[model samples]
Target: LVALPHANAQTDPLPSWNEGAAKKSITDFVARVTTQGGTDFVPVPERIATFDNDGTLWTEQPFYFQLAFAFDRVKATAPRHPEWKTTQPFKALLDNDMKGLAAAGEKGLLQIVAVTHAGMTTEEFARTVLDWTSTARHPRFHRPYTELVYQPMLELLTYLRANGFKTFVVSGGGVEFMRPWMEKVYGIPPEQVVGSSGVVKFQIGASGKPELMKLPKIEFVDDGSGKPVGINRFIGRRPIFAFGNSDGDLQMLQWTAAGEGARFAGLVHHTDAEREYAYDRSSKFGKLDKAWDEAVKRGWLVVDMKQDWKTVFPFEK
Candidate 1:
């Protein structure tokens, strides 16, 4: 067992994380796994760590950030389609009626996504998302949505990488949506991002330029069981460490913990409402109920947002 870092250690890698069981657990796990002759020793080549994006890395309360992007796309493109002004979901969306949009539900949300997220070539869609993320601000925080990422988690990412861990983002958000800025924001590159995707096609444009066209149909949903399938398809290796915030990530965590050798699984519990938002079982976005119980039952580390994190967002520091 490697010695734990002192509370006032000058080289503390996770200063934003409170000195507690959660932080100690993470440090100890890394220390043990990295020790050359230790029973838990893991080779650098096998140091795979996967993280869920939304609430695990950043804020996902009120609604999902991608849904917000879809809504914004609808408004931006509404001028081209006059019918959307009178359509059920579009009208509700354009009207800025939260209740009306909620009532529209999954089908309605899908209609909005199909219109806004598809039809364009992958390059075109990438530019569109880039533009939107650059200017979009969170509704309540009023800061750019990118700035809403949890500070402690950012440090954790760096700390893991410093210890020779290869980090990968496995999110439920659109792969294209995240690929554009993930490297810039999270230190994880595009090739390492695995997420929900839509059908795309290879085609030659009118100008004879080869391109991939985005289709409006769903190809994969990288949530719940889909996460593991994506891991298998894209990563080709089992992750030894997994971090997530909701039940959707339960299967991923289970898969990680079940791996051979010393495995670690962690959950981020959103228990702070003042600094961030407080939510659990009943939350519409990033529901954390079943997974919370599962974490306890499985002896996984659960980081309480309010208690375990000394600072929530980067801006708070």
Candidate 2:
């Protein structure tokens, strides 16, 4: 490893990361995982790090990526289910019904994604994500979904690479869905991203087009305790460092913490509602209950959005 920052002085890494507590956390964790005598230290190349994307890296105020998938899904499916126009949750999402969306609850949102994502090919699903993000913007932020990512977290990703850690996004999000834009938004290349994925097969249509289809079946979901499962599947090693926000990430943090020797786990508590959506322990989306308790008990770092971060988003207010 070279002495130069942002790279091992050997493998050049994300250079755009800024200096901050977030950055420190990242560096300190990487040091623990890679140093020779470090308790959490493993080797250089084997230093695998995992992160949950939605609430952990960005905002999930509205919901997860699948929720956004559902929104577009409902619109596409509405033509078939005409009655959805008058239905409760469908009706809300259809007519730009923010109020109805609020009323739909978790079950309503899942209903929307199930119908939209299950049967499509992986390629078609990717296309849908690209197309939807092109037009969709956050309602309150009024910014493109890609633009809603947290700047500090982005910087943290870069900073980790400066050390010896190989950062991987082990998110609950649809793998194909996030692959397209995450590179541009987070500076994390597509290959480094590990998220939930439906089965995909390469197929050439009779029309002579390359189409990757999303199977009507779910192959895997990279959420909850599944985070560690995904890490094992994709990166093939237990990570030394893990970052997450909600209870859904409990298993991920637990798995990371349970590792032998030096281990670091951090949670980004959404405490700044004025700047971003702030709800924990009781929020409908991205709730932080069990993880919050565990974070305290285990002496894991719990970041209060209002206290730790000097800034949130990239854009200046």
Candidate 3:
């Protein structure tokens, strides 16, 4: 990894990325789009790039951060409910027992998210996420979860932005869920994050602050078809590059690489089982079955996690 120049009017674009096939592809694409001499240059500077948040940027092993947040929320709130001590998943979470909750599966996780996430205002929820992310440490890694983010990916984000690429996190995870701390963690601003979101309505509080309420119903679940839809609605432009780790991102990658002119699409495979939990076609969190097949079929770069990545997380200790 190289020390990159800050984003400025004349920063030599995409300096953070390495000098390899990946770097060459990215550099060439940007050059084609911006350089006057390059053939088939896109006149407009609309290089939208989408990335999946979980498993792509950070370690998503034990489970997703949002899920862990929801579980913690249940633990914090379960005492107030009292009856939760007798409930199935709620009781499991209240006891700080994730294995029991796992026995209940994804439905159980959703229940935890709904009860803890649905009633609060979106702003409150966002603040809560920020608060939690700041303090919470990953269980196995024993580092702040934010610190567990892939260093190479961070480099790639900077590289893209340097090349005049507008990056968006098009994730299956919640939008209000991620936008809170992503700016600090990923250098991605809140507006650029497009993800699954609960319906948010503006409400004027007694303090006269305009607050956004988080409705129980989901306004969007930005996975599968929703990823493309979110991109169309939020970006209004087809992406030139897409990066993802799972089958959930197949459509997003497809849409970007299929577009006209030079495009880049790649998948990050989790192969380092010792450093991080390895799961691909068989695993639960970010399953890679369809994407693995499609990546090969489409000639998309399949990044072998251990080989392509020089480092996994940002924590030095």
Candidate 4:
């Protein structure tokens, strides 16, 4: 048997990150929190880092992955329910009409989610998510969606964990949807994830077995102001560091930065159109409008994707 190689001593913790102010700020903040007897030093147990999953941790371009999954489910379930052929949103989804889908709006999306995500037990949903995540690929990248996660962000998560900081994903995506694969992908376990979710009921099924059935009704919408509400409700502690990429995350950033002691907030600006899709202020999905102003005004680290990252995904590295 051959001996395994050890980690390179000269390897940078954030190898995908280029030498820049944004990278420096992250390293500096981590240093401050871990340094003993320093004014900015924080206890290991108190070092909670929350990250918005969509654009902040991975890609949310074109559409949210959950939406994509819902669309695929609509197609798969169409054979069972022929009435979907005549339905408004379902017809739009079947016809591949983006405009019609948009016109259907939140109501249409909720319908899709209800039909696709509900009725099944949480375990069933977990299995479905696991199978899909293993097979599903990003339309643009032509790689498994899990493989599309940003390398720099992955490095940051690893770096934080190494420094005894606990990392948690606070996304607007479905909590159950994220929980299945987050531990494998982000090194953050299921208990540490907080996200929007539908209601669940514990009941005996027709098979005479007890199960937690997912319901269509919304239990919570964890975005904007709701982010802080979720953080307080779930984590029970204000995060020392918050990372996000949209106006939806402004309140979370504000909440984290407003806390006493040295706080760090970062925004991942999608500026590299060549390596990744870029749209800000006017884009429908993951709009970075009001938050950009706040980042500048508050002197928060705004990471320029083009300038700050040497590589985008792990494949590039």
User: What would the per-residue lDDT of candidate 3 be over residues 197-280, giving only the tens digit for each residue?
Assistant: 777778897789887778777678899878888899998999888999998999898888889887888888898887677789
What TM-score does structure 2 among the candidates reach?
0.83
Listed in order, each prediction's TM-score against the native is 0.96, 0.83, 0.89, 0.96
Please report, in order, the local distance difference test score of every candidate based on alpha carbons.
0.92, 0.78, 0.80, 0.92
Which residue pairs show collisions in model 4?
A: none
TM-score of 4: 0.96
Predicted candidate 1 versus true structure: per-residue lDDT over 1-317, tens digit per residue: 66566645558899999999999999999999999999999999899999999999988977899988998888888899899888899999989998999899999999888888899999999999889988988899998788889999999999999999999999999999999988989999999999999999999999999999999999999999999999999999999999999999999999999998899999998999899998889888999888899999989999988999999999876
* Candidate 2 minimal-lDDT segment of 10 residues: 9-18
Candidate 1, superposed: residue stretches over 4 Å from native: 1-10
Worst 10 residues of 4 by lDDT: 2-11
TM-score of 3: 0.89
Candidate 3, after superposition: displacement of residue 3 in Å? 15
For model 1, the run of ten residues with the poorest summed lDDT: 1-10
Instruction: Please say which candidate is ahead in lDDT: 1 or 3.
Output: 1
lDDT of 2 by residue, 69-129 (tens): 6787688768889998788778998999788787888677666766777666665667778
Q: Which order, best to worst by TM-score?
A: 1, 4, 3, 2
lDDT minimum window of 10 residues, candidate 3: 8-17
Residue 186 Cα positional deviation in candidate 3, in Å, after optimal superposition: 1.7
